[model samples]
Target: MTTLFYRKIYAMKTADSTEFYVVRHGQTAANLQARIQGQQDTLLDETGELQVNCLAEFLKDAKFDIVYVSDLKRTRATAAAIMQYHPDTPVFFTPELREWHLGALEGRSFAELNAAYPLLMQQIRQSSFDAAPPEGESMLQFQERINRFMEKIASEHPNQKILLVTHGGVLQRIFNLAVGVVGSGNLRPLCHNASLSVFQRRNAQWQLAVWNNTSFMHLTSANDTITL
Candidate 1:
């Protein structure tokens, strides 16, 4: 994983209203095999179930007024586990929060895709700012939708604590939006499975205070959440 930034636990008055947690969905069978899921309705494997369960335990004390989840099974399962702790928090679903649609390359492995679309793959390897995978959404399309979603969240939930259970692709956009670079290049923070990231709305600006943090989980159980 890229160590581009460090984690700082930001704390504010209990009355602070603009705080949210972005959690990546847990591991899936495709993830273990190194295949791209791309909006696939893949179920969480046994490991995923365990990962979210542990995460839910760690967040048992957290208070969220609302929860948002991608319209995918993996994210839904993960959110359900966490919602167990926050029974009163209402969960909402939206396609805008789904992962990058891979289209024809949905179930392909990285190596297979590299061999097939060598140049295009390499160009987008670092940043997926301008690559189209068969019938997949273009970079422009992806950016537009994500920016719209970000705007909605910022506008709708002021000074309220919320949670988003989504894919790594969506989480990357959150990082980009925080730094005021929504669709420049492939500028995104590494988001681990079931990892928790945090942001705050201070002075009317979004700050990416925490990136890819899983310290809430026990050391042993957290091993599955990280990538090599």
Candidate 2:
């Protein structure tokens, strides 16, 4: 339950400006079971639902202009909880925002994957930018996918506060891109479930405003007995 928040000040505001409030979806069955999930769509468990509701309550005052979510079930559910209050606000579903395609690794427990392909798993953990897991997407491929999705968002909404519900891998890539950090060597830790990471656009550049603000975690814990 550590909350991290950062902000940058900028004077310029463009007519096509966009503020991205990125959120990782609530915990899924895969998360609780320590599975690779990847692009697989899983429904939110009871705790996951509560987590999203808490996040919705925390973000209710922010008044986002638009809500965007991955087409994946977990992310869609998370976005639904937030958009419930602002029924008038439009919600956009994008498949490009989906999690890294885990390929054959999808829906398998991490332990099982490692046990079956220990060396390959080791290579991935050691930095497998070019190497793809057995029928899985490479780290480089994931980065490219995230970049395309981000560029689309930039083009679609330039000057508006947007709420995005996506996955941990996608957000990590975005953090790296915004900070001018690239490559699989220096990946940021995965975002927490239902956590918010804010980014601001200024002078045609994206700046990281915050990284993994878990205020929602506190709010969720206040009313729920579950621990993640």
Candidate 3:
């Protein structure tokens, strides 16, 4: 029930811009338990199913030219719900959009990770963007992956509407990129499960249009450490 406001960036609409509608996958049992999903391919729980069904109906009339989804089950399932309304749109499932690889931290709660991996927990506490968990990606690596995917899409789909179904980590990173947020302690936009965030890339610049929109679901969402 707290309200957070990020610095908004405004730009003139151009013919070369691409409109992006980004959706985070719905709630999962892991999310409810505060467990780290991190590419674990968890399925949607009942609440998640209902959330997506509502979201699907809300976006049924959007004129998206193409759809891109993370290959993870949660995102795929969410996208499937929405895609039923856009049956002919081209949908591409790619691992490039997967959540941050959490490695040994996967499936463990934050409390459990603090107990099991003190050093890793300390690194995270210190906001070590370059530090990675055992067998996982660093924050920097995750950001780079998102950057590459975004650049590819912006380059390839100018003047087109895109529907991107992916993880909250990706959406969080995109929010940071758009608003020039750096370091730690700054408030990040809340990424509710099954929420929709909109962005536009015009002349190679990213502008955030909407964020953390869950009005269609008509319900508060669960949060997890992995998703922020």
Candidate 4:
């Protein structure tokens, strides 16, 4: 694993300032099956619903100025769960926050895809952000899309606390670009279900405040386990 370190050039901002809390949705059937979902729409399972409910309870007392979510069902469901607590906050949906398009690998189990296209799989594992799957969007395309989404969020909610429900790949790219950790040839490890990550902007520059924070789990039932 790569060791990451950042210098704290500024103090953490108050809650009223522009703060981004990113969340990856709970697990879906595809995730449980270990299949590549890409752009394919998948619904969250019972465990996912419970996880989101736990997240909702955790945020019930917190305040948010705006909420954003991917148009995909999984993200939408997670957003809806969060909205149960912050019903008055506006929720915006955008496709730009969707997962990386795995193209021909979509809906295929990882084992099957590796068995069928071993060379392609190997290339993808070793490729940089410009790598493309057969008939799929390149990493560059995904970066552009994520950048646009981040720009829109920053422009629209410059000084408000904003929550975004999105995919793992989307969050990974955002973290990479925000902290100048680009082109590392690998995405950050997958985000756990209902995990919360925080980002802050200061003086016109963005910095990662937290990454893959699972503390929200404390709000859930002691027996609760997020399986995604």
Q: Kindly give the number of clashing pairs for every candidate.
A: 4, 7, 0, 0
Which portions of model 2 miss their true places by more than 4 Å?
Answer: 6-17, 220-224
lDDT of 3 by residue, 126-200 (tens): 545755888899977877798889989889988988899999888988887777666653334568888888888
Better of 1 and 3 by TM-score: 1
Estimate, for each residue in 37-103, the C-alpha lDDT of model 2 and write its tens digit.
Answer: 8888799888888888888887776767788889999999999898888888888898889988878
State model 4's lDDT. 0.77
Off by over 4 Å in 3: 1-14, 122-127, 182-187, 219-228
List TM-score per model, in order.
0.88, 0.89, 0.86, 0.87
**Ranking of candidates on lDDT, top first:** 3, 2, 1, 4
Model 1 CA deviation exceeding 4 Å by range:
1-10, 13-17, 219-228
Comparing 1 and 4 by lDDT, which wins? 1
Question: How much lDDT does candidate 3 score?
Answer: 0.81
**Clash pairs (backbone) in predicted model 4:** none
lDDT of 1 by residue, 139-199 (tens): 6577677878877886798778888899888887777777888443667566778888877
Please report, in order, the local distance difference test score of every candidate based on alpha carbons. 0.78, 0.79, 0.81, 0.77
- Write the residue-wise lDDT of candidate 4 on 1-228 in tens digits: 121332231344564457887888987888888888988899999878888887777667767888889999999999998898887888889887899988988999989998998877775665367567888898778878888878777877878778899988788788876777666375555467667777876556777877776555656663255543
